[model samples]
Target: MYQYSEFDRQFVRLRAEQFRDQLERWQAGQLSEEQFLPLRLQNGWYVQRYAPMLRIAVPYGEISSAQLRVLAHIAREYDHPDAALLAHAQATQDELQASQPGLTLAAPPLRYGYGHFTTRTNVQYNWIALTKAADVMDLLASVGMHGIQTSGNAIRNITCEALAGIAPDEIVDTRPFAEITRQWSTLHPEFAFLPRKFKIAFNGAAEDRAATGWYDVGLQARRNSAGEVGFTVKVGGGMGRTPIVGSVVREFLPAAELLNYLEAVVRVYNRYGRRDNKWKARIKILVKAEGQKYIDAVEAEYAAIVAQDGAPHTITAAELARVQAGFVVPALSPAGIPSEVSITAKPYQRWLKQNVRPHRLPGLSVVTLSFKRPGFAPGDADAATLDALAELADTFSAGEARLTHEQNLALPWVHASDLPALYEHAQALGLVQPNIGLLTDMIACPGGDFCSLANARAIPIAAALTEMYQDIDEVTDLGPIDLHISGCINSCGHHHSGHIGILGVDKDGKEWYQVTLGGADGSALSGPAMPGKVVGPSFSAAEVPDVVEAILDTYRAQRSSAAEHFIDTLRRVGHEPFKQAANGARHAATERRSHARQAEAATA
Candidate 1:
C-alpha cells in the first residue's frame, strides 16, 4: 500500500474544505444548480434515482484498515435517508410497480446504511443525503480518502490488478507506476474535462485480472528483450452502447516516459474526440471510427509533446524510487501465524482451493473474501461488516486489504500458515463461500433499485440466481463461469465481459432481461476479449433464473467431458443451441404465467 505523504494529507483536507464552502454557498442560494453541478460532480456527488450517491476513490484498490474504519463510520452515521424521504421514495417505487400489471417487477425495498464496492474498486453510498455530502467529504479526508474526480468526466480513479505486487507471474509491480500516473492525472488542468469520461487500467500479471481490454486506456507492464521495464500500451477499449477491445498503440513504451506518453495520447483524443454527442463521446468510439488514422494522430501528438514541450512529465528515477518505497512489503509477525490446523477437513480444503491464491512470496497467500451471497446485493458491506473487515485486515493481512475489480475484498499479505484461523474468522463473517470464479460469484450493479438510468432491478435477479445455486458441489461441478448483470447498458457491472451476461432492458414499460452468451474478459480461461452475443428476445424478470439455468443445461448436455469449462463448451459449439434453449425457457415460463393467471380469473 502507498502511504500518504504530509503534502498529500494537506491537499485532501484543503479540497474537502473547499467543497464544504461550495456546498454552503449552494445551500444559501448564492449559487445556482447549474453553477454547482460541476462542482459537486468533480467532488464525486451524484443525484441518482432516489438520493445522492457518493463515490470515494480507493487508488489502485489499496486501502488501509483506518480508511476502512472511516468508510464504516460514514455508512453508519451518514448513509441514512430522512424518514419522510424514504417513505416518499417507497411510495413512488410502489406506484411504478403497480403500473405494470403482469410484470414481476422484482424490485426489492430501498436500502441504505451500506457501501457498495464498484467494479472500478471505488466505494459508493446510494442513500446519503446531499446536505451531508460536505460532512462526509471531511470525514473521508481525515483518513486520506476523497471523492475527487470519481464522478465527473475526468480521468477517473486509476486501477491495477489486485495481486499487483504479489502475483507469482508478474513481470513488474504496477502499483508504483499506477500511483505515479494517478498523481499526474489528478487535477491536471489540460485534461480535466475531456470529451467524455475516461478510464485507465493496468495489468502487470500474465493473466488479465484487471480487464485491461475493457478500459479507455490499458497498460500492460512488461520488460523489453534487454530486461528494461516498460509498458505495452493499448488504447480505445471500452464497453457501453459500444463494445470494442483496445488496440495496441505502442508495443513498448519506456517506463520513464509513461506520463509524457499518456499526455500525448489524451491530447490527441481531446483534439479529435467527438464532443457533440454524449453517446459517441468516449475515446473508444473515436478510435473505432478513425482506426489507423487515430493511431497515427496519437504518434504525431507524441512527437510534438516530446520535441516541442521537452517531455516535461517524464518520470525520473528518483521519483519512481520514492513511489516504489511506499509499497514495501509489510514485516510479518511470526506470532500472527497460526501453528496447527485440520488441513484435511472438507470445508477448509475447499476454501483453501477456491478462495486462496498463490503469492509471489513463499509461505504467504492472497485470499479473496466472497461478497456474492444470498440476500445482500453483490459487493455491499454494511457498517458492521466494514468494521469487521478492518479488524480482519489488521489481524490477517498486516492491516492492509485490496478491493478487487470483481467487487470483492482481497487480503494480499496473508500468511499461508494462518489459513485455518483466517478461514474460521471469515466463515463466521459469512465471507467464506468457496465460490470464487464460479456461477454464484457473479458481478451485478445496484440497477433500477438505485440507478435512475436502469430499466430493471439487478439485485433481485442476482439474489434469485444466488439462492438457486447454493449447493457448492453443483457450482464447482459446473466449473468456472462469469455471470454478470447490469440494470442498463452503462456496463457498470461489466456485463459485456461475462461468460453469461444479463442486461436489464425496458420493453413496453415492463422490466425484461437480455441474455448474451460467450463473452470473455481477455483471461487465459476466457480467451480473447469480446462482447457476448445476444440469444434472442428479452425475457421477463420472472423468467431470468430459468433462462440462465436453461443456458447452463444446454452447455452441460453439449459438453464433451466434465472437465470442460462453460466458456470452453460455448466456444467449441456455437451460440445457436444455447440461444434456442434460452428462448425455450422463456416460452415455457410465459405459458406457466398465463396458466396461473387463467386459474385466478376462473376462481373470480
Candidate 2:
C-alpha cells in the first residue's frame, strides 16, 4: 500500500473543503441542479434514482487494510440501507403468480449505499442519502482520499494485471510501473478533460491476466534486443457499443520512452477523437475513423518526445525503485516458508495451484482470494469479512492487501508453510472455495442496478449461470471456460473474450438477451464469439437455469471428452445445436410461457 505524503494529504483536504462549500450552497438552493451536475460529477458524485452516489476509483485495484477500514467506516457512517431486503417475495416474478394463489404486490425497491467491491470494473459505494455531497468529499479528503477522476471524460483509472508482480511468468514487476502511471495520470492538467474516458492496462507477464487486448491501450512488459526492459503496445481496443480488441502498434517500446509514447497516444486521441456523440467518443472509434498506419506514424514521431525532449517521464530506474519499495511483499513471519502448506496439500491443492503464485522473492508467493467461487457474489465482501481480511493482511501478509480487478483480494507475501492455516481461516470466513479457472468462476459487470448506462442486471444473470452449473466436478471435465456477461454493449464484462458470452439487451422496452459463442482471450485462443442469437423476453428465473443446463447438456452430448473445453466443443459442433436446445419447445423452462412478448417489442 502506498502511503500518502503531506502533499497528498493537504491536497485532498483542500479539495474536500472546496467541495463541501460547493455542496452546502447546492443544498441551500444557491446552486441549481444544472450548476452542480458537472462540478459534482467531476468530484465523483452522481444523482441517482434515490440520492447522490459517489464512486471512488481504486486505480489498478489496489487497497490497504487501513484503506479498507476507512471504507468500512464510511459505510457505517453514511449508508442508510440498514432497513433493506428483509421481506421475502417470490424469488422470480413467475413463481409468485402461478404456484401461490394470485396476489399482486410491488416488490420494494432495494436499499442504498451497499459497498460492492467488484473484480476490476469498479468499486461502488451506494452511500448517497446525501443532501450534501460536497461535504462527503471533504470528509473523504480528511482521510487522504477523494472521488477525483473516478468519473468524467478524462483518463479513468489505469488498470493493470492483478498478478503483475506475483505471477510466476512475469518479465518485470508491473506494480511499480502501474503505480507510476496512476500518479502521472491522476489529475494531469493535460488529460483532466479529454474527448472521452480513457483506459490503460499493463500485463507484466506472458499470460494475459489483465485482458490487455480489450483495453484502449494494453502494454505487455517484455525484454527487447538490447537486453533492456520495454513493452509490446496494443492500441485502440475498448468495450462499449462497438467493442474492438486493440491491434499491435509497437512490437517493442523501450522502458525509458513508454510514458511519452503514451502521452503522444493520448494527444492524438484528444486532438482527433470524437466529441460529437457520446457513444462514439472512445479512442477505438477514432482509431477506426483514422487508419492504423496514421496512428502508428504519430507514435513514431512522438517517440522523440519520449527519448529526447524527455523532460522526464516514464519509469526511471530510481522512480521504479521508489515505487517498488512501498510494496516490499513484507517480511512475513517467514516469507519463504508458509506456516501450514500441508493442510491444503490434497483437495485444496488446486486452490494453491491456481490461486497462489510465486512472488519476486526466494520462496514467498502471492495468494489470491477468489470471489468467483460457486455461490458467492463476485468481488463482494461484507464489513466483517473486510475487517478480517484487513486483520489477516496486517498480521500475516505484512499488513498489505491488494484488491484485484477481478474484485477478489490478495495477500501478496505468504510463506509456503503458512498456507494451510491461512486457508483454514479463509474457509471459516466463507472465502475458501476452490473454483479458480473453472466455469463457475465468472466475470460480470454491474448492469442496470447501479450503472446509468447498463441494459440489464449482470450480477443476477451471472449468479443464475453460476448456480446453473452447480455440478462443478462434471463441469470441470469440460476444461477451461470463460463466460462473460455484460448489461449492455459497453462490454465492461469483457464478453468478447469469453468462450461463451451473454450480452443483456432491451427489446421494445422488454428485457431480452443475446448470446455469443467461440470468443477467447489469448494468443493461442482468441477470436470473437459469433454475434449472439436473440433469446428470451422476460424469461423466468426458472427458465434461466434451464437455458444454461441446455447449453451444458448440448456440449456434453457432442464433446469428444471432458478434456475438451467449451470453446473447442463450440467450434467442433455449431452454435445452432445449442440454440435449438435452449429455445426449443422440449425445454420446460421456456415453454410454460412463450418469450414472444420480447420479440415483438421495440429495439433496445
Candidate 3:
C-alpha cells in the first residue's frame, strides 16, 4: 500500500474542497449543468439510471483496513435506505421530475449497503446522492482515496496485476511504477481531455493478469540481456464497439524513460486521434484507420519529444527506491507454516484448492475471497460484509487487502496455517463460495438496473446463472470457464474476453442477449488474443440460462478428458456444435412450457 506524504494529503484535501465549492456554485445556478458536467465527471461522479454513481479509485486495488473502514462508514452513513442520503436522492429525483413532467423515474431498489468492485479494480457506489457527493469525496480524501480522473474523457485509474508483488513469477514489483503512473497521470494538464477515456495497465508478472492486451495502453515489464529492467509497450488496444488487441508500438521501452514514452504516445493520440465522432474517438479506431502509419507517427512523435526535452523524463534510482519503500512486505512468523491438523470439510478443501494460491513467501498464501455468491450480484458486498472483510484483513492479511480485476477480494498474505480458521470466518460472512474460475464464477456489469447506458439487466442474469449453477461439483466439473456479461457493448464486464460472453442488446424495446463463444483473456493457453465471436442470433433473457447450459453441455461432450479445459475444448471443436445445442435447448424449454400449459388446460 502506498502511504500518502504531507504533499499528497494536502493535494487531495484541496481538490475535495475545490469540488465542494464547485458543487455549491452549480447548485446555486451560478454554473450551468453543461459547465458543471465535466467538473463532476472528472471527480468520478456520473448520473445513472436512478441515482448518481461515484467511482473511487483504489490505486491498483490495494486497500488497507483503515481505508476499507472509511468506505464502510461511507456506505453505512450514506447508502442505507433510512439514511438521509436516500432522502436527498429522492429529492433530487423529484426535482428532476418536477421540472420535466414527462420524465419517468425508475423505482429505487432495496438498500444492500454494499459498494461494487469494478473490473478495473475500483469500487463504485451506484446509489450516491447529489447532495452528499461532496461529503463522500471529503470522506474518501480522509483515507487518501478519491474518484479523481475515474471518469470523463481523461486518463482513468492506473491498474496493475492485483498479485503484482506476491506473484511468484513476477519480474518486477509493479506497485512502484503503478504508483508513479498514478502520480503523473493524476490531474495532468496535457492529457486531461483526450478524445475518449484512456485506460492503461501495467503487468510485471510472467502472466498477463492485468489484461494488458485489452487496455488502451499496455506496459509489460521485461528485462534486457544485460538484466536491465524495462517495459514492452503496446498501444491502441481496447474493447467496446470495436475491439482490437494492442500492437507493439515500442518493443522495449527503457524503464528510465517510461514517462517520456507515455507522453509521446498521448501527444500523438491527442494530435491525430479522432475527435469528430465520439463513437470513433478511441485510439484503437485511430490506430485501425491509420494502420502502420499511425505506429510510425507515434515513433516519430517519441523522437521529437526526446529531442525537445533534451533527454526523456528519466527515473532515478532514488525516486524508484522511494516508491518501492511504500510497499510493505509483512514479516513472516514461524506460525504461518502449514499445519497437519487432520481432515477438513470437503467444501473447505475445494476452496483451499481453487481460491488459494502459493504466495512468493513460502509460509504465506494468497487467498481470494469469492464475491460471486448465488443470488447476489457478482462483485457486490454490503457495508457489513466490507466491514467484516476489513476486520479479516487486519487479522489475517497484515491489515491490507487487494481487489482483483475479477471483482473479488484478495488477502495477499494469509498464513497457510490459518487457512481453516479463515475459511470458517469467511463462510460466516457468506464469502466462502469455493468457486474461483468455475462456471459459477461470473463477471458482470450493472446493466439496466443501475447504469442508464445498459440495454438489459446484467446483474439479474449473473444472479440467475449463479443460482442455476449451484452444484459446485458440477460447476467445477466444467473446468475453468470464464462467463462474463455486460448490459451493453461497452465491454465494462470484459464480456469480449470471457469463454462464454453475453452482451445485452435492445430489440423492439425488449432486452435481447447476444452470445459469444471462445473469448479468453491474454493469459489463456488455448488461443491468440482476440475478441469472442458471436455464435448465433440473440436470445431473450429468459433463454440465456438454457443457452449457457447448452454451451457447457457441448464442451463437456466434446472434451477429450476431464483434464481438458472448457476453452481448449471450444477451440478444438468450434462453435457449430455449441450453436446447435443452444438452439435445441431453447426450443425444448419453450416446448416444455407450452406442453405444461396445454396439459393444465386439458385438466381444467
Best by TM-score: 1
Q: 454-513, model 3: which lDDT tens digit per residue?
A: 887787678768767888889888888888899999988989999889999988777788
Per-residue lDDT of model 1, residues 1-604, tens digit only: 8988999999999999999999999999999999999999999999998898999999999999999999999999999999998999889878766765455635667778999999999999998888999999999999999999997778999999899999999999999999999999999999988999989999998788788999999999888889999988999999899999999999999999999889988989998888899999999998899999999988888888899999898899999999999999997656455635578989889989999999998989999999986768999999999999999899999899999988999999888888888888888889999999899999999998889999988887898889888999999999999999999999888899999999999988888889998899988889889999999988888888899999999999999999999999999899999989998998898898899999999999
For all candidates in order, the CA lDDT equals 0.91, 0.68, 0.84
Q: Which stretches of candidate 1 lie over 4 Å from their true place?
A: 95-107, 336-341
Worst 10 residues of 1 by lDDT: 99-108
Clashes of each: 0, 21, 1
Q: List the residue pairs that clash in candidate 1.
A: none
**Cα displacement (Å) at residue 414, model 1:** 0.8
Over 4 Å off, model 3: 80-111, 331-343, 524-527, 596-604
Question: Over 4 Å off in model 2, which ranges?
Answer: 81-113, 132-143, 300-315, 334-347, 373-376, 523-542, 585-588, 594-604
Q: Write the per-residue lDDT of candidate 2 for residues 11-36, one digit (tens) a residue.
A: 87887777878878888899998998
TM-score of each: 0.98, 0.86, 0.93
On a 0 to 1 TM-score scale, where does candidate 1 land against the true structure?
0.98
Ranking by lDDT: 1, 3, 2
